[model samples]
Target: DIYAYGSTFRGGEVGVVIVNSGSSAHEISIGGLAVAVKAMGWLVTSNETSSSDPLSARGVMWNGQSSPQSFPLLSLGAYSASLSDDGVLIELPPYSAAGLVVYF
Candidate 1:
């Protein structure tokens, strides 16, 4: 199962949070925007495909970075979303979460 939540920010930016609970990948598209100029966000997922492995819990990576304490100011990599004809296209991996910001 996949869930998506979205809200508009103060500066006309749209923030979206997506969660995939099932053990399958999905490609989703979001619409109802004026014109999306940019899309960026962070993804959290484990190295293993399934979370059944106890050791996989320690393999969680945020935006491709394994260590969260390594950065002094909590910087997220420039993870981008693709702009589709319908709206914004995002890939949702199994048992993963993503937070995105869409600017118009």
Candidate 2:
């Protein structure tokens, strides 16, 4: 139901990406990040949260493969849902310590 707009299976470079899990807690990649969300049957914009970072950011997720606690990445498209740490960061995070990053 929720996946990268372009192609979930081959999310190569359609301007959209997925938030899958990884080995470490901080697994997702946040560089050149962007997101799209559909909530309450309504649409959201990634204007404020959307950033064209050349350095690369990261997100933190407790549930990526299982559970419904994947709050950081609520959907996949071009909107933003309270963007968090995606993994692959130069510095460590000070948040909850439970981050599931997806390198896109």
Per-model lDDT: 0.77, 0.29
TM-score of 1: 0.77
Worst 10 residues of 2 by lDDT: 38-47
Candidate 1 lDDT trough over 10 residues, lowest sum: 47-56
lDDT of 2: 0.29
What candidate 1 gets wrong by more than 4 Å, as runs, is 50-56, 69-76, 81-84
| Model 2 residue 98 CA deviation in Å | 14
The best candidate by TM-score is 1
